[model samples]
Target chain A: MPNRNRLHGEEGRAYWSMVLPAFSIYLLVMAFPIVLSIVLSVSNYSGGKMFGGEPWGFAGLKSYARVFSDPLFWNALKNNFYIVLLSVFGQLPLGFIFAYIIYRRLVKWPGFWQGVLYVPNIISVIVVGLLWQTIFSPNGPIAEVMNDLARAGFQSRLEALFASVGGFNVDDGLVSKILDMAGPAALDWFSDPVPELKELILSYEGAPLSELIGDLCNLFVPRWSPEFLSKPNIAMLPVLFVILWMYTGMYLILFLANMQKIDSQVIEAARIDGASEGQVMRYVILPALSGTIVNSAILAISGSLSSFSLIFAMTGGGPSRVTEILSIYMYNNAFLGRPNLPLANAISLVMVVISFILIGLTKMAEKRYGGKEE
Target chain B: MSDEIKTTALGRIGGAAAKAAAYAMMLLFTAMTLYPIFWLIMNSFKSTREFQVSQLAFPKEPTLSNYVEAWKMGDFGLLFPNSLIYTIGATVGIVFVSLLAGFAFAKIASRATKPIYNGFVIGILITAQSLMIPLFLEVNLLGIYNTRFAVLLVYIGTGLPIGVYLATEYIKAIPSALIESARIDGASFWRIFAKIIVPMSMPVAVTLSILNISNIWNEFALINILVSRTELKSLPLGIYKFSGSLSTDYGKQFAALTIGMVPMLLFYIVFRKQITRGVAAGAVKG
Candidate 1:
């Protein structure tokens, strides 16, 4: 027993020594930033002042308040929720369905299907943004389809009648004017630098479908949609679309792998018990996948919240700050926001807090579900 | 007999219908997944005018000008080597460090070190996003901000947690007797690790290396922030430059994206099973 204890002590020393270097590195690189961000959040320092002899002073929660009260911040927050929801509900389910179909039901080459789904995930976000931008551009294929649908000759009589009632006259309506202007001239949708599209959209506040159609027509026609990087709202769409597209495969792969682990006998039993396909999916598959569902949802939410590089590359929070997510907001503040070092640090702190809350909540949920399994 | 035959026939019909539906869904998703890539590749060979005229359709007359233009404009020749060096160097460092740490955690008989081992798990929870600012400051202070070493160091630091976790889990499955026998023969800890643990953990190491290689190769944000010089930028950053320089040049941009992604795509194809298994294992474990 004494020899065993001595051996254990030796082992302990050896283990600690091995791990110490890596852990120390992680502490400095990871923990230091988090602590520093907290310190900076309450301080007052601007760009030149940061580099100069300006002393850090307490500002309490002023930066947080500033972010909370800013309309742009609220807009970005709302947009982020929209993105999160879209990813969790829209993309996650679609990915699962795709993964399920490929992995379980489909009898063909699974590798081929896997590769196909993973293409977007492998491509860079900038590339995805550019591809979608081209596809959705007025002169791009989708717009051409819309244009064809708009033409009087192309529409069915009932559709034409509905269009007229909807105030979409091919000859006189905003849609027609937009198609004429942008189809030929190539309109900048997001960044006109003149803010014509913004004005047009903001000006038509009360009208319903007709007004939106008019604004879109004006936006898409006559100019190339502002460089995706410059126009925040328009930029957000393609960026979100690409993100949704790219991550669908990853989430799909996860779900499919989990689905594979579900005992085949259980599924067979469900079938043998006369459960309909829909019923089997609703009861057996979904419940069995609860862990993954919760995990993926949390991941998607946290991911959307922390996303930076994509938005930075795609939009950069421009066209007057329409597409700024918290991560990008913090980054812009730190690196480019008037060189306001204190404010940037404050934003980073707030970001960390937000991420911590989100991840903490996820852990709680994971414990609730995963606890039983373990 | 007729009734039984009828039931069998109905069952066959139902199965056929389900199979058909499944195939349709798979085909549709496959198209959605593959079409963009196909379109990108096709666009690479087209002139700007051809791309503009038909985004989805095949080129009227294929041309190599886009690829040539993208290569020259993107400066991929310089970017590729920089990325290769960073990715290879970082991956090697990560694999070595993680293996050592993982072995220590898994095989070492130390109750006192459990907390420290668990602490690395916390590192998994703290992503790079949380520490970007501080890391930048640290790198800058260390005076290696724009150097390849800075980026490589960051990768090693960020990658350690997951690498250690994976290695520990894999190494734990190995019996302690194997190491004990080696030690009884008077083998040193280093020898045991090198000859026994390393050989036994080859599969996991291979999987880990591939995962790290792909991740480090495609990494953009850290490299973007750390490397200020354009020539030293990685593939993802190089593609970003291509996008910025030729903002309006869709054909060339697509060409560059296609070109840059080829290596990863090829890697995936060659090692699909290993890569997917590694990703799945990492995801579930995390």
Candidate 2:
């Protein structure tokens, strides 16, 4: 009886040993923190104070209320939506196009192209942020090129109209006088006005030449002038540009990989049935890739919601809170704002819930469409 | 005959156009992708003053002085060895522990242990970001904070889930008949694992090692939180500090970034096929 009992115990011990390592890791890394986050969210736990020093007391729903009432929180939520929209609508499709072009062997040296495309993904976010900041800065190469283009456009349009009226020389003072009266600050094409105008054109939607003229008229003619960054409706444009530039490549790569996995035979069959490329794409390829698209879309949405590093590194959620996402606001609340730990935790918890809800919806859609094949 | 030939010619023209259009799109994206890295490398050779004034222009005369300055000031020579020690130590420990745990899960059948295994699966759901602060406190409490050992422990713990999952999947594919045969021959369990199991699972091990190396090399937040001592800093943290200290020096910062990325880049190049296969397999298994 003793030997039989000992053998059973050894067998039990062998079984437990297999699971102990995994259990220990889970306990330390996952289970502990999840419990701690809930506790911290309920109680007042500031980083400045030690575990015992602070009057460890619970504050009920006050933290949640504070987050809801804050204007910065609202702004951040809105900005997050903007990022999600841009990433899903803009980045996903573009990524598919790129991946499709490369994977179909339409492009020579696909590996080199893949390497080039993958470069941005590998680089640190800080580096990408800094690179973009320089590119979009007022004095950067992009701005310089924009200014030159604006000047050339203005010159050609003015010359064409003047010459059409009869034999009118552009070198004459007539055009100069007209421009001086109508142009911003009577500035030449190479000056600040041109760059600003270029930026406005790149960002805002309007009739191109007319918009330029209207902007110039406003600048020169007083009544039409609007603060560029503070024009109420247009302030979000710069922030949008920055967010789009940073995340587009990441989403693109993900979607492209998914698109590549759609079997070619299905597409070929559709094509042989006299279906157009658009129809084949819409019917066969899109249905097959729907799960991947939805998964990527969900990821993009969550990523946008939590986006901090790029926005923080680039804009610091600046130009009057126009670009602040929730994570940035949460960071501010914890570190820079009132050091309101309860409020920060409350906001973070809300953000976490929002992320889960978004992911949950995507999963539902994915199931409806048929789950991704492994 | 002429009409038939003309229709065929038109079809070829259409196909060629489509191909050309595709190539055009690829070229455009490739340029966009290469631009930033190209900019970083180009700017790394320029003086700070020059970089500020002309963001896109090539340096009048490129220099290696920035690389030298970054190498010495960052104390990269010393830091590289420290990083290597931490990464290799943590990776070996994680691989070994996870392999043992994974093997047992794959081979053993104990009805009472199902819940425990399920608990390990739950670890995958929790994001690393959420646990960082709590883990920092725990690391401090354990009295290993600021030491290489603390960072190593955190790295191993963080890497455990994926490693175990991969190992379990790989081990499951190995036929139980082999283990049974070894057992029939009177081989001990330890000998069977070492001689039969380990050799067959080398591909998975190599794949896991590469994945862990890439992850640990690029890891920043954990290193930042766990190691307050500058002397024990990993490459990411070291480069971040080096960048901040030399604020005006774009050249040095780029050089540092380039240096930090080199090991992973080289690893990826050397083991591209394995790495890609590992990622694809791991994604499915995960």
Candidate 3:
């Protein structure tokens, strides 16, 4: 202890030698960038070598002002907010529920289920995002399903009309009537169903009630458009869905691992005391895991705010930046297009500020509720 | 008493129904998670004609032509090795450096130790997005931007905080008596670290390796920013580029995705237990 407490000479050098390599890289990679970003946020450094062609000048608040003023920036911020809300409210609760179910042995083969559930988390986010992207694409699974439904609806309606007319004759009036019934929103998509109808007329069987129901339901649902991916309002939904799919497993394991540490006797005692399953979860498990829940909320908020790769891979902030979260917005600004490095830095700084504020709020709430639970 | 019996009977029925619902929910989620990858794999083996006919259909006549085409077009031959080099290089680098630092931090007593340790932990809070722009500048300043070395350096750097945090906590749990005995043998610090501490910390090193390997393997954003060259880029970047350029070719795109994920999936299958356990252990500890 005496020898270890105070080192000198070669021993002191050894201590530093071990620590410096990792610490220095950390500074260069993480710490220095943070400071440099703050500085760059104020300066109008476009791109290329810093201060290369044009001298760097301070544009105090200009970059931030531009970001705040930009509608796309706000859209990106709003999307990021959706992601944060999804991660905190959607993924965490779902993950916690899954973890609880497995913990309580509510599902058979808990290990198998746990392993299967966690599969998405271990795969590359880009792969998951791309897989989902393809699934949502025009020729992908969703389009196929929707297209089938669209076809079925046309056939069923045509059949009903033909039965009313007492014939399978090719009537332009019947076709026009059906098209009118489909409404304007479906018009563009419903275009050119006549040839398909002619083909189906020769071999069409009577539609089942279930198929008719499905066809009816498809009318109310947003028609799957090939341009949906490029449409501003609808584009972010797929990215958000993929994010939920990809991350829930991490929190599941986090909760399950922490839950396992809660002595079995505690849960058993709760049950013995006539606490129903819901009561045990609400009273014992929830309060006991409140700390981990708060920690996970902090993780989710920061992670959501900073998430980049999946969105980058899936949407790349296209469709006029509707799907752009702050990270993607920052990346697109800094690296892509005109390369507004200062604006990117400004966006990043805003991200940092937002993360801190959210995390601080999470901590504050945790303290308040956690104190009450005690 | 009769009323109580009736309520208990209702409670039992409710509980059974709830259990059934939970099972159904788990099954649904499992399908949601696995079906896409399964569909991708199934579609990858189909002919372009067959895929266009029905994306949902099992490959009518399974073929490897798409795989061959994707392998050549996606530049997997180059990018696969590049990804391996970065993942392995960063993972090994993280393990060695963090082990050394963790040992020092745990065993040594110095005024500098606490602050240095805290600095690494503080790094856990700094998200990679905020650092991306400035790190791009820093990499350029260092003249290593668009190079594999930049990717390696940043990967190791971003990885260190969690690595060091986990290692320090794990190493601290190792008994001091072993270090004391080694010191009494007049062992130099290097010898002690190499001979005693390194051997003793194999568990944490394995966990560290697992965590870093998986993370670095999947990482894209940092590498995307750091290196623009196709040859220098990793699997995720390669797959991303392919998805955009090969958007029309469903077979080729699925083939490329399968290639991108297969190695990691294989790695997961081989080391499933350790990977899951190691991940849980790492997260819980951190």
Residue A78 lDDT in candidate 1: 73
lDDT of 2 by residue, B180-261 (tens): 7876798765676679878988888887887777667666756766887768987766676543346456778767767776
Tell me each candidate's i-RMS in Å: 3.7, 5.7, 3.2
lDDT tens digits, residue span A1-374, model 3: 55455679978999999999998988888888878889999997877667566688888989989999999888987887898789888999999999999998877798898888888888888888788878877778888887778767666765677678766455667656655666574455545765544444435346454454344345534556575577788887778788888889888888998888887888777777787889989988998888778777778777876688888778778877788888888888876768888888888888777755764675576666554322
Give the alpha carbon lDDT tens digit for every residue of A1-374 in model 2.
01232224534465466567766866776666556656667776666444555467787787787788888888889888887788778877876766666655656786676655555544445455555554555545566565555555655555455466443222335444545545555463436544444454445443454454445444444322233344446656755775555456555455555666777777666666666555766787667776767766766765665455555545566667676777777766665756776666676667656755764675477568655643
Better of 2 and 3 by TM-score: 3
| Per-residue C-alpha lDDT of model 3 across residues B33-150, encoded as one tens digit per residue | 9999899999999977798788887888899999999888878899989999999999999999999999999887787888999888766666776678888888888899888888
Window of ten residues with lowest summed lDDT in model 1 chain B: B1-10
* Docking class of predicted structure 3: medium
Model 2 misplaced regions, further than 4 Å: A1-11, A47-55, A147-276, A301-308, A317-322, A351-372, B1-11, B72-79, B112-117, B120-122, B141-144, B185-192, B242-248, B278-286
Candidate 1 chain A: minimum summed lDDT over ten consecutive residues — where?
A168-177
Question: DockQ of each candidate's interface versus the true one?
Answer: 0.43, 0.31, 0.57
Which number leads on TM-score?
3
